[model samples]
Target chain A: MKNFHLDRRQLSVPYLIYLVLFVVMPLLVVLYYGFTDDDGNISFTNFIVFFTNSKTMGTLVYSLAIAVIVTVICLLLAYPVAYILAKGKYARKHSFLMIFVLPMWINFTLRITALKEILTMLEGNLAYHPFLNTVICMVYDFLPFMIMPLFNALTKLDSSIIEAGYDLGATFPQVLKSIILPLTVPGIISGITMVFLPAMTNYVVLDMVYNSTYIMGSLIGSYFSSYDWNNGSIISAILLMFIGFFAIFTERILNRGEKEEQRI
Target chain B: MEKTKTIIKMNNVRKSFDGKINVIENLSLDINEGEFVTLLGPSGCGKTTILRMIGGFDKPTEGEILLDGSDISMLAPNERPVNTVFQKYALFPHLNVYDNIAFGLKLKQLTKAEIDRKVSEVLELVDLEGFEKRSITTLSGGQQQRIAIARAVVNEPRVLLLDESLSALDYKMRKEMQLELKSMHKRLGITFIFVTHDQEEALTMSDKIVVLADGKVQQVGTPEEIYNEPANVFVADFIGESNIFNGVMTGKMKAAFAGTEFNCVDDYETGKKIEAVIRPEDVTVVKPGEGQLNGEVTSTDFKGTFYITFVQCGQYEMEVHCLENYRPGETVGLHVLPDNIHIIPYDTSINNFEGMIDGFVDGKGLFIVFRDFSMFVDAHRLYPDSSVSRGRLIGQDGEHIDYQGKKVMASFQPEDGDMSDDAKKGDIVGNIVSFYYIGDHYSYTIRTDNEIDYVVDDEDLWNYGDKVSVILPKKKMKYRLLEEQKQEVAD
Candidate 1:
């Protein structure tokens, strides 16, 4: 009995070992490399160089712009589909939602390559419209992420609250504005988080679609491939910080909308 | 007494989903201004459907829902001057208490100062004066109910619909809200239509009660009339604890039931079929041989102040409310007073089925074909006005009308039905689906092979699913014209 009791708590042993070795150690190594200079002296030389370079700064800003645009477009496209699916009188809603999610289950490289072909066929030359093609590919790849969270949150909404809105003399549009939009803010925020954070760093789509432009993910990759460990580690840390900021921002929006976990 | 204005009237409302079986049939009701009317029934009885139709959430399949003498059937929920407090008190979780209450008022585009005054005033009315800033999720269920009511009433709707609003709360909280809602109804002086399956809540809160079952209105009256003088078996069985018995009127002032005859106040004719209902509290317990009937106590359940003691005099058990405790097997007499005995006429709706008028033979009889059986009944039974002469039926207007291929409805009373154990003694063999003791005899439902169910009353008990033969009397069958007979009569 005593041995079994100990084993119950010891179940987390392998997970903790993997976390410390694979995750924590790599993060510590990145921190060590990021704080040191080429002569092995601890310094902020890499940060000063990355910040002072207008090219890298412009790439960061362009990546942020792409992420923002992709997120807004994904939200616009997913909200109505999720609402209609969740409004639910359709006999096979899960199968209907599956149709929306089926593309996400495909291999990422194959799906992006197919989208690149479709884009090339549509525009004649993908490099001629690198920004548009990348945005399209990024949205296509990350759409299911936005759709799943939104569909989940929307299906969980108490429809009676919407009826209560109509009962309170709210018209259809007014009910959507006053009741549904506010209630699904948490869903909208989660969709934004899933799309925005990934869109910033997913340079795979950029490379697959067009290589003329560089996002944060490609900048970090180029630095790492050149054996510039100090600059690559610094860029990774900055991207991680940006992700942390995005998470905190989404959390504020989610909390503001009174997430369902707060319900009794 | 001053006359009150009719605030809402439902005219022959019928609501069916998918154009199939109707959830609500041709139901008509009237609600006066300032009346607290409760639509009370079991689940799936269309009480909530009625509320939804009234609140403009659902449209009737065929009906005119009039609001203060104007048809509001075509109006949207927002366009209608009615509001509903939903069953779960559907408070918008994203909005604060103040914003939630001010929602409809803000839609009216009132000034901010005026909106504030109105919101706070309605909040005070529901006794949630200081809860304006409270988040809907943070407040308790009871507080949410108050705020929901406040939100709905702030708009000053002409009629307020509550679809089992208090049903979500705990027992004690439900009781408190019942009283608070009653006072709110009185203060607002607006028409309130509340729906609940809980009969006690309906009795306590409603000035009038509309008892419903199977999408049909059973009875509509004051709470006392509904409780004391139920219209039929459904209302009597649904309202409160009732010892209902299928019996007959022994005389002008007497009722015979429970294997005995007793004085009753209803002036039903002698030998007329009826039902007698006596409340548990109405039976006065007496010494053995002192009252009308003597019995031994079968069971005694202590209910706070009084014990509901069941006395078995014969096959039927009588429930009596007594302050003095009685042990099982103790002998006692039950005195049921004349005024206490509520005599309801036995409802006539029975085995009605769509049938075709097969033919009429010159000298024999009128042939009617129902499911799985064809029979010849008297011509006069179809309608007292018509006659079968020379192989053709004459209409009420004396025109020669072909009766074959015409549609009709064949009906018979339960009392006219009989059951036999031997197949040779009856027309059709069936299985007894269920049997419940009703004072003097067991009321049974028997399903035939063709899926036709016949409700028959018999003195002998039958087990469930027991095979029996039904004796459907030819003379007892009545037929009514279905469609073209009316048009012919009008022509």
Candidate 2:
């Protein structure tokens, strides 16, 4: 029995090694560079530089604001589509879902280029507006990611629970409110995380659409391009902290939802 | 008994999933107020489909479902005055027991105090008053079922549907909950429509049992009526353990089977063919030569309350349940009381073959050729001094008879033939073409070498592709002279 147990546990060794090598090692390197100066001596100069630069601070806020908009828009568009795919009469039409998800299978850069061309053709000069263009591209690219998680959440939900809601004198809207929405909290949280983090830091999408460097992603890119390793690592570390805070916030929201669920 | 009002009525209801095959065809059932009715059938027999239609989860392709005199077939599940406790309980994992029960009341925008009182009252009804704060996941299967019941009952709809609600609980818990549900039905005084494949549950809890098979209602009656007098072979076989035999009703209180005429209680046409069902418990075991039919005990199982003894009388296997201990291979006689014998009138779909007696062995058996093929019969009763040889059976009269050419009619119950794939040296060769598990045994439709289809039953396992021989024991085969019948003038 002991040998069998050991044999089962050994299957995870490769994954453990990969986490330490790729994830822990890179985070450690970023921490190391964030605290060191040009002489490779320990110092807080890069942190001061990142906090004091008005351009970097302004870009960070602008990136956050744009990510919030993109996340909101993606959620608003994806929730209903996901619900229709997962629970509606046409739920078994996997080929219809394939239509929404087919673009994801193509090369990312090629898909963005094609989308840029279509939007350019439709709006002409108006499509070139920097913030609007960036927001549109982010929502377009991240909407599938948002839908996927929400769809998974809605699909795993026991259909009988919704029926039970209806059987107990609740109308369609009441069932959705009392059962479907609260049950899919995990999916909504994951969708927000998936779209929010990428929308905050994806400079390539903004560059391909707007042809301008205006967000923290672009700021980080310019720092790396100039070979400012110390300041670049510091900004990267702060962005990691931002994601960490957001993750905690989402966790808090999930816990609060769970608590409310129990009280109900 | 007071005249009960009909709370729900399904009129000419038909349901089909794919439009080609109907799951429920032309079904009409009336559920009385405060009565507990169970739709009992095997899987895929449309019991659940009926429940779904009544609960509004599914709509019938045709016909109307009346709820208290109004057609509610087109109404949504929420709009109907009905609720359901699903098989899996379907309690919201996110909600506590109190809230789950209070959900219906809260949806009506009831005041907080009203909802709380109703929820608490329902929780008390299910015997889980203190479980108000417990999470649904934390409860046991029985508790969850109770909570599901509480959730539905809290709505106080005109009718409540339970789709095998206690099926998930352990046997002990199921028994307990069955009694609890009966009492709850009395207390609530609302119509309850239940669906289950378990006959014991249906028999114990239902005021009315509707036995369904292949999208048709076979019998609908009280538990005692369904148990004592089954409508047909399917109902007799499906309800409980029964010793069903092919018989002919010769007169009122008289039926003939297994070469002997016996008294029965059922009154039918004198010349009508019938199938007789005698419940195992009603058959008494007497001394070898004392009772109606003599047989040897093949096996005996001591069931705590009584011994289930299997007796072989000629070609018929009769099951007898009694407290008396009997050794295997002991000679015994089965005394089936007159009233205990139930006669179901002839079903046209039974297997009746016209054949000729091909061979005969004096004091041993006879061989009958059917459908251009011959099968052995182990019966010992035949005309004495009859010129019977290979394929010919001639009576005492001096007649130039071709033994292999005489015609006869053979008939037997589906359960008579014993099937075996390795019995290659038997009297008949057949392929195990198709089979369905009819609860107790597998009912196989075997196609003989002559391309004749015969339905047979086997307790032993056999697959679809098996090449097998069906051995029809002579004592089990029932036959009469077709030529003799043709000679006689029709009435």
Candidate 3:
């Protein structure tokens, strides 16, 4: 079972246990609740109701749109910052990386609470609008998740590759484009997954700051509060499926990047 | 043929990391078109600094660097008509061999067909014709090195700088690449300035070698001139194996050492101390009595092509290379032809010899002088006038006669002795004050009963404070009286 050439059994045991405890058990419970009517007869009523509701469908669209927005913003801002931090002088990198990472140390709840307070203050006293406040909060919350991986990818890259490009007569801009940017795709993929997944799932910052925001997290929260367990279960199931599909997509992307690097 | 013209010239280049300490000081050199020059030296000798200056990667703190006789000291590395094959052979990981070679041509806005043609031509030149589409990481170290050369040369720069590019390759591969690079230089006719610390590499490939040490250029010449005729002691010692003997000029053509006088070809200014360098191969071993240098063979090492023998005469051990195998502990005679010997003046500014004096002693109750007692035993065989029957003094006779027994002082010469039985050869003994184990033999410093000093080598183990008799050969000793007479006549 523990042989070096075939350690599948050794790894499978824990994975099986985890699958039974967390995934299988919760999924079974959700399915049980989702299929049963109020009296206990099996039915497809909850899923049907979930699909028919325009409000829940609109919530999904809003959630997906916001996630895409946050992911794009994080990718853009993280790339340049990460590039500069990795290639900049030692002292400059130290100070800039410190500033970029400082917010990560704060507790998630406290950070969101702080954002909420700032948003309220900005809306009331500074006369800023809610949409800009929410965008700013989401970007601030997810930035480090994006920047950390990007920085790691950029810093670990061999400077020789860039030098080779320059020596071969590529201008500075061409080196960055052909050599540096291509080599950093893995980090970019990782940053995208890190920002998109968490932002899609996380609702506290959005709720605390953007209370009226019609997103999936708020819809799920409203269903549970109204004692609509069947509807909530269906919504949760859809969210799980969405996350599963993305997980596979991300893995595929990462693997492709790896293969490309190897080929190069 | 017209393209083969003077490409680069660096004049009085100086650089320093810290404002006060210069790493490359007042360096100047010229690189002709199509010529291969190597900067050879030990580490921290500023060879790399000069290469960097020529490559335009570094700015000279003082002086100017000219490319094709135009000042390009202030130009960036890219703007100069030069490229570098770095020690690491920095290759783009993202680019295939074809793209790596095409990168420069592409940057110049060359058309696709031209770029492809040039890249293929270079790949063929480097013997990587079929490897154009291969990834750089997939290539072996030697292949990568060739690619590096190909990439640099394909640019058709007037000059290419290689900073230890072959250092990463294994010995056989390095040798192969060296030949390849040399042939490539001949075919392309591009100026190549190589920087390496390996003497053999510089000797094998370079048209000229510039030897550097301590941020200064020691000598610049062909491999034969640098190796056969070194400019100074540093260059002599750095370039190859050399046996150096420190001595003072005794006559117009004579240098006395180890109780023997040798006629030297080069004349030194009178009274000046100088060192003589002879290649070990120049020394020939013969029967003890027949050769000018008589010494006991302390040890012999058999290196496949030659036998290296260490011989001890008096206090100094001379290294001699001979073709014949000789056993250790055998007494032999060594002879070196006068023309083969090179004498270089010792720079007294750095090495102060006065501090080497052992102690001051009263000689003949007159002049008080410091004694190098070890030197005296070595001197017995060196001073011709000192024998068993006669003695010679180093002091002025008038001073000793003036102060005799009043404020008694005296100075003694090891060469000053008599040949009488009471003080005959091998009769005057001294107590060994100290012994230094110098590899194959022990150098013993003995102080005689008359307070005179002597130095000699003993193959046999002898402890400090042991009583040892000094053996002064009669023919080897001389009286300075005749030399004094000659000096007076000449004056």
Candidate 4:
């Protein structure tokens, strides 16, 4: 007689339940509070208050500006590093990758505290340059987030394609422009999303470096701490919507790029 | 014959990965323009290394590679007028078929119109006219292969190097691509240097075949010449199915093997040891006593085109391929015509001797005569109370004694001997005839006095034609008593 055995896929049931309870249920609770008032009455007042408050509106704009700058800076820095790590002297590349990833192993708050101390020593009274300090801190913390994806994409590239480019009379610059950069677009988009979405609302990095909480993430934290769950939930729901739109936008970019490549 | 221009010439090229071992030693070859020259060998035999050197993907450790009488050894791959279709058609996945074909041309800064025209022309040549807009991943392996060719050939390189390009395709696809590649070579009129391990691929498409083994070239000839007149035992065994035997040249154009004297076309020195190779298809079956050799059919296998019949003749098995099948255990006679017999000078790489054990002490050592030389040997484990070391017989009183003669058959592995360059301090003197670096050790064939050959596996690097002395260790040598000697001792 054949012995009964569990199908391998059935083992993932616990994980599926955990995801629904911890992830989907929390989003649903926020959505329920976002569209209701404290008296259990339907209302749009929380969203209107979030949109019209001058402090929140200015913080959102400043947060978006800083996130865009950090994402661009991280991309510009990571692309070359990832390329060198992927295609340079093969023996040294792995150790170099280890050096980049070693920082992530340390506790995140411990790293931020050390960076803040270093910045305070390098430049006296970092409070006056809060914007610059926060942007710098966010870029430093999330740089690996950018590098990890780009490095993965760059390393997985077929080396023969590069050789073929050279064989077809292409110079090094031409090969990179025409072949390497175009093929690594998915990594570029994913790296951008990982950096931009996190850097936008990560007030802990800003608060640690500048000793101030002036961003939308700080605004939402204050609301929740003061027992104004209604407004905090509204702000979080809007942020989720923005993050969802960004994900779809990047995905669309990837698909469109693929279509363009096929046209060629 | 009209003189053809030499396109590429590799002179005394040697390549080594580490400083200690050489992969290709003293290899030199020339490829004529517009000819399909194939570097054929088993894998790791440095065939791909030669192709890489020609394509400028690799540089040799020694010597020079010349193109059109100019040294191009130090030139980069792109700097040379050569292109390579890599083993698996490394097509760019990001680009379509047309863009891949036009990649090289666009770098030349050609006009867009000119690029499209060239791409379309090459696409049409490869019979992929409608595949211009198709993504590379969408095409089948064969279509991708054709696109790879079109991409390389569209550049109009002076030389094209194919590094086992058809190895990934199926059997039928490979066959189809072989003919297509041959026609492409003719139409392009460019020198093609192909590398493959398949002998049939070399025979089918190459105008000239260079057979290599262990990073050394064995022979260079046309397919017919290589098939019919193999240079050595390796080539004869590698090119086709053959029944090879140890033969002795008794007279001019006459050799004896398989208990019969056969007439051969090749003339050799009288009394010279040789090897004979006969293709399986060359043997004909006849009635008993009607042919040169009589044997019984042991087994017959139907192989679609023909039947392979295995016949056992006097302790030797010969395979015969013919249309007529015979039943198992049926008596049959086989005959090989004069032209079917091929004789090659013997090149032995192993040593075995039929000697006699002259005498042995019950608790001491033994003495044996091998090739008329009496030597003392340690007692084998089968016999107790007998011991010897370093050619000295151990006495019961712990002193050395001598045993002059014995009748025995002695054997020793070639690696168990010490070979010295100084000829004076030696047991056997010989010249190194051939040497092959078989990865771990050097296999050397040494021809001693009276045409006796001994193969030695050594770690030292010895040049060809070096005279050396070989001494076999007493502990490593093995011996057994002859039947007559045992009977005489018993009586």
Interface RMSD of candidate number 2:
4.1
Best by DockQ: 1
State the DockQ, from 0 to 1, for candidate 1: 0.56
| Positional deviation of residue B273's Cα in model 2 after best superposition, in angstroms | 1.6
Cα lDDT tens digits, model 3, A88-167, are: 65657867888999999999778877877766765673234545666677899999989999999899787656655655
For A121-181, candidate 1 gives per-residue lDDT tens digits of 9889988998888888888988888998899889988888888888887888999987888
Off by over 4 Å in 2: A1-29, A32-53, A89-96, A125-127, A251-264, B349-491
**Stretches of candidate 1 exceeding 4 Å from the true structure:** A1-12, A125-128, A252-264, B250-254, B287-290, B356-437, B440-491
Fill in the DockQ of model 2.
0.40
Candidate 1 lDDT by residue in tens digits, B176-239: 9999999999899888999999999999999999999768898999999999998877677778
How does candidate 3 score on lDDT? 0.74
Q: Sorted by TM-score, highest first, which candidate order results?
A: 1, 2, 4, 3
The CAPRI category of model 4 is acceptable
Instruction: List, residue by residue over B1-491, the lDDT tens digit for candidate 4.
Output: 66799999999999987554667889999889999999998787899989888887678999999999999998877788889899979898878888888888887788999999999999988989988899888888999999999999999998998999999999999999999999989888988999999999999999999999767899999998888888986787777787877668989899988778889999999998887888899999999998888998999999999999989887667889989989999999999998998888876435776665556655454656666245655565323444555655565665654333444566677668778888767777898876654223466777776556677778789998899888766677766654443466676
Each candidate's lDDT (Cα)?
Answer: 0.87, 0.84, 0.74, 0.83
**In model 4 chain B, which range of ten residues has the least summed lDDT?**
B380-389
DockQ scores for all the models shown?
A: 0.56, 0.40, 0.25, 0.35
For residue A2, what is the lDDT in candidate 1? 50
Docking class of 3: acceptable
Clashing pairs in 1: none
